[model samples]
Target chain A: MKGKTIIKRYPALLIQGGRTQKVEDWVAVEGSYELYLNDTLVDTIVVSPTDLEAHALGYLVTEGFLKPEEVTGVEQQGDQIFVRTATKKIIPRKAAHQNVIYRRREWGEIPVVSSTLEVSPALIIQCAQQIPEHSESWKKTGGIHCSVLFDQEGRVIKAAEDIGRWNTVDKIVGYALLHRIPLTKKILGCSGRQPEGMVLKAARAQIPIVVTKAAVIDRGIEVAERLGVTLIGFAREDRFTIYAHPERVRVAFSPHLR
Target chain B: MKGKTIIKRYPALLIQGGRTQKVEDWVAVEGSYELYLNDTLVDTIVVSPTDLEAHALGYLVTEGFLKPEEVTGVEQQGDQIFVRTATKKIIPRKAAHQNVIYRRREWGEIPVVSSTLEVSPALIIQCAQQIPEHSESWKKTGGIHCSVLFDQEGRVIKAAEDIGRWNTVDKIVGYALLHRIPLTKKILGCSGRQPEGMVLKAARAQIPIVVTKAAVIDRGIEVAERLGVTLIGFAREDRFTIYAHPERVRVAFSPHLR
Candidate 1:
């Protein structure tokens, strides 16, 4: 881990209560990582310095460029990761349709996840609250995003942090792929807002539930609903809002009946 | 205005206080916008579906794809904006260098903003606090980002909201360009974190100061300092942190010499 370079202190002028003071503040490092497939540049992502390998692999997978099994080898040289896949999956440059929000690889097909993984509301809130404690960079700089993957039994499979929320998800997915951990039974929790891109990452990974400590946009809910992913937002403290696929939440008791 | 579709109500299951309730919640709309320069594809950006003309023009200028003067005509057709420029400034596909973070157009030149515009710390705080009140979508959905452009005298030039921070900056810049308002003396206030990409937008537009109610990553500060832009982060309530070019912040009184 590049812990030393991840959070560096910088001189700053702080204004508080109508007064100014010079202070040194710890700031998160934002760096770029390049992904290469068979020596061809796939894309460049902005992320924290840590977990470059996981980020690269996960980005390729979650972005639907490469399936996990298609990867034959992975190598990291400096800020770039060169991966040899079974076949070169060249990412398309244009929008699948004019309405594609992100620079999508292909809007060819939307994968439907049928994981059927169920979790209680308590577990969802617990994981959402744990993001702050798990995020080391966020603790120091109050910047960067944290993403955690949990097993069906609420065990921490892996946790990752990055300057970009998408990078954090990509890191988590990459870690699972590297360790050969099955993502079908995992629940993904993020500390950033759930946009269509973020939800699509969890859906592509076949993670059943996505919990966030922030809001979810309209398209995210639409995608989550169509893809059979359980989308939960505002997941902080003792509450969370389930935007789609509420069946997998497994509410044990109904207060409405009483 | 797509006001009806901007904030849509979705049925959600709210889990709170160890119980669940069915409720309808407001969610901000996230749509994809494609920018075509002289019938050629420039890029597709994810944003809230409003002020798209400003977004298209702003995106073109801020991303260094086209300068303000180069833009001759802009027409909106559904989700796509067809732009005719004085010159076909095709954005380069490759990274200018190996270490480029975002999918930059070109890393060829770093423009140094020489605008000596200064502002009081109180005005910065006031603008930072005013973001919530000025943001209509945020007031309803809490899922959008707000940005405002202010002149050196602290007058509001434009205020915009979007699902992406970069879009907000683009909107502000586009608005300035279309209205023939110069950005050299403008202060850009955002309700999002300051990253290298965000700072570069301000620099590219010649905006002297960038303020945010969030943290400034290390790369953001580095870029801001190199490009001669004032970066103020965590500008909320009565406090703010000046990460780069603190000289632009004209603090009349300092307790340090006392």
Candidate 2:
């Protein structure tokens, strides 16, 4: 459980109804943590400050840096994560400063999401309602973005909440990899906008259905459609928009009927 | 305008009332844009894909990469942003991947925000209502984050909308720097969570007040208090929670009176 990685209390003035009242409320704490590969700085993340090992591992795995078992061990300092893999490689100076934004035309060629799991609307709404309950930080600060990996029966596999939506997804992925929780047939649910990066991460994991309580961006829809991953957005208690394969969701989504 | 960086249309399947419907809607287009510093890769960003110059300038300035003026010119190709700074320095390998997460212990040493502008609650509420009108992408995809720099009389100085909240702030900051828009005594309003990173960006610019339609995390409050900036969160049509510096707001946010 990567819950309440950091939370601090502060007195706030709630000005409403023409009245001012002071109340103590919990606020999400964000800290910057550095990740080092072979003692060379690779990345820095500002998060709710929980799950450093998992974050480092997941980030490495997703960024194509390292495989799960390839890493011998991970060490952590105050705000730094050190991952020692089997081979130590110094990142090329030119590549080190490469801040890149990329989209591949061939990403949709082969979709790994071949799960036959049937996720009903009830199941999605049930999970969307339960997403906030899994995070103490979100309840306290209303400031966290949460991601939960759930089994077919609504059992939460691994849950992670972070101020950065990407970190939350990374935490979940790391938890799954470390615990060996299968992702292929699982449902990934989150409370943040689904951009292409988020969709790409889930698609890479072959997560069948990605559900959210927020809006789905245009690229998110494209990636999901191309990757054969089902993307459900604005997943309120009763309604949801499926951008990709709805047949796999046990619902007949008729785009032509409209 | 950075408006419609990319908008793609796709047929979507809708499920509600135990019914199936198909519809066509506008989806946000996200692409990976490689940022270059004199033909050297600096960073990559996946965004809905508008406002390359603003995004490049804003990202450079906020990330402490370079001052806006240091950038001599900007060139864009399909999905690449090439920033030509005063000098093409090969960032030392060590400094290349230097990911920094910074928190200042003494951010309130001297309040950069000494503006006497008394913002009425009505003004904040009015701006909150007006923020939605600024972004066409948000309306279409329901997937964009928008920010506005508003004046004392409720005139919007610069407004930006992006898939990344950070990028949205950078766009606004870049607009200000490019157009020489005055930030002091102005209000910066956004539609995302007020985390420390966002707050620090505003504080660094000496913006007196920062408001959001979302919640403020604890780190955001601390940063605002220490940086002599007023932070207003959970701002809705008629109400908002003032986390730090309420006197600057016309409403009596008396933290000491309690």
**Model 1 lDDT per residue over A1-258, tens place:** 333243343333332222333444333333445667788776554443443454455445423345556777767787776777777655542211111023323322656887767776778777877877886556656666778888877778777665556656755764565356877888898888776667776776678899888877665676777888888777767666666776777564321210
A24-133 per-residue lDDT for model 2 (tens digits): 43333334556688888765543334445544554454233454456777767777778786878544322322111112223544455677788666787777777888
Candidate 2 residue-wise lDDT, B1-258, digit = tens: 234434333332222222323434332233345667777776564332344554454444433355444667777776677778677744332332212112122344434556777777778777777787886556655666688889888888767655556546655654564355667878888988765657766776667888888876556666777777778776776566666776666543233311
lDDT of 2: 0.60
Each model's lDDT: 0.61, 0.60
Each candidate's chain A: what TM-score? 0.59, 0.58
> What TM-score does each of the candidates earn?
0.61, 0.58
**Model 1 pairs whose backbones collide:** none
